[model samples]
Target: MSFAERYGPWAVIAGASEGTGREFARQIAAQGLNCILIARREGPLKELAEQIRAESGVECVTASVDLAKPDAAEQIAAVAGDREVGLYVNNAGADPNGKRFLDNDLQNWVDLAQRNVMTTLKTAYLFAGPMRARGRGGVLLVNSGACYGGSSFMATYSASKAFDLCFAEGLWAELRNHGVDVLSLVLGQTDTPAYRTLLAEKGLPLPTNWASPVEVAKVGLAQLPHGPVYNWGQTNDVAGYAPNSPDQRRARVLMIEQHSRSTFGDD
Candidate 1:
């Protein structure tokens, strides 16, 4: 059976151990899309794979590799080989502590770039080759909404996502007429395990009306066709870039950065 036929379509997601990445896997499972779940920790990924297979009744494969390591892309690509990949979700990333950009350790930036930028870029590029040749495929890059302007504390994370936004949209335009769909999700606050930890550490209240993983996943996946650039919200995350209000885009980012840094020492 063909890829789109066997699993009904297949999606490979990086950073599948937790948060949005895990949700993406479950969402793909709901679509009957066979999934290859990748992450640094094998335990969580394997557990997630089993849960997806059992709950959604779709096949799930797990790969544990630090996508930041050299040659990691090749290793991931080899396993992903010709599975007739129809969808690729580049969701792996790390948030450097809220620190002044220059004051932080240099290695943190390198590590973030390797995971947030290089890994995702290489995987997407490798996957797109088959997707393009097959004339059918979809790609979704999970990014922070901070890319609109970014934050002082979260500088590196925000800039890294900016790369994903550009890459996805550019590819979307190229593939639009060719049958491949490339999309980006500029995600807002979500209810994940990390939120509580961050909140407790910072001694701050949780953001009101934050989204859940399932909610974000449903909207993000549905909006893939509208083509690159979507904001996850109460419903579909298909909203394009925001209006040009002075602070609607940039002000909040700055405020959040200031607050986040003040609460926890920037890493």
Candidate 2:
């Protein structure tokens, strides 16, 4: 089966307003999948949906939702209706305010956790079930190099991303046999509107080296079937991106699976 045949008819993107998430929606639509675009900004989200419909000739559904809210996942599901969501791109988590842990408001951290961790789990559980039953689909979690280790600032963000990485990998292992591809698309310093806004707010210059949202989305789609993880650019050696070889990550997943099976008697 083709890409659309295996994972098509409809796809949902969690952060489809701009940057990488927007790119992912466009790419998915281009591949013959109708799109459900979700974002906090309604105007941009609707504009993107119209653009996708015009450019790709596919139906586009727009949902303005704050993923940090407790009912965010349910809101998305409502927008998706009963359409089979063959692809789910969880790209809603990004910490634009790069403040030290204590410097930021406690509520901000809570909301971030809700958005990145809780909503992710809920949506994945919602969509992955049907995908597993159907025997084909994909879950693409857009992560970051910050996930590799702790950082002075962005403590909550890093921690959340680490959780996402581990979650995606585990899901990949569990669903690969069921024909559901799960990929943690780990990126390093991508050139996105949010990143630029954050830097501008801090009065800092743009990084000389940054990944392109377009390329990142393309690589993510191409590498979905080869999952557990794909470290984009392999840059940011300091944050431990370079050391994340695909073979090593895959082996680690297998190793942990073996340990779990042995300990639990594989149910």
Worst 10 residues of 2 by lDDT: 234-243
Q: In terms of TM-score, which candidate is strongest? A: 2
TM-score of 2: 0.95
lDDT of 2 at 120: 99
lDDT of 1 by residue, 1-267 (tens): 443542247788887888878998887887778899988899999999989988989888888888778677888888777676788887776573566789899888888888878888788888887777777888888877777777787788888888887677667756765677777777777777666677768778988888888777778777777655666652332234443322232334345555777887553
Candidate 2, superposed: residue stretches over 4 Å from native = 235-243, 265-267
Candidate 2 displacement at residue 241 in angstroms: 2.8
| Local accuracy by lDDT, each model | 0.74, 0.90
Clashing pairs in 2: none
Q: For model 2, how does the per-residue alpha-carbon lDDT over 1-267 read when each residue is reduced to its tens digit?
A: 899998998999999999999999999999999999999999998889889988999999888899999999999888888999999999888897688999988999999999999999999999999999999999999998888888899789989998998899889989999999999988888999999999999999999989998998999999899888888865322224445576688888999898999777662
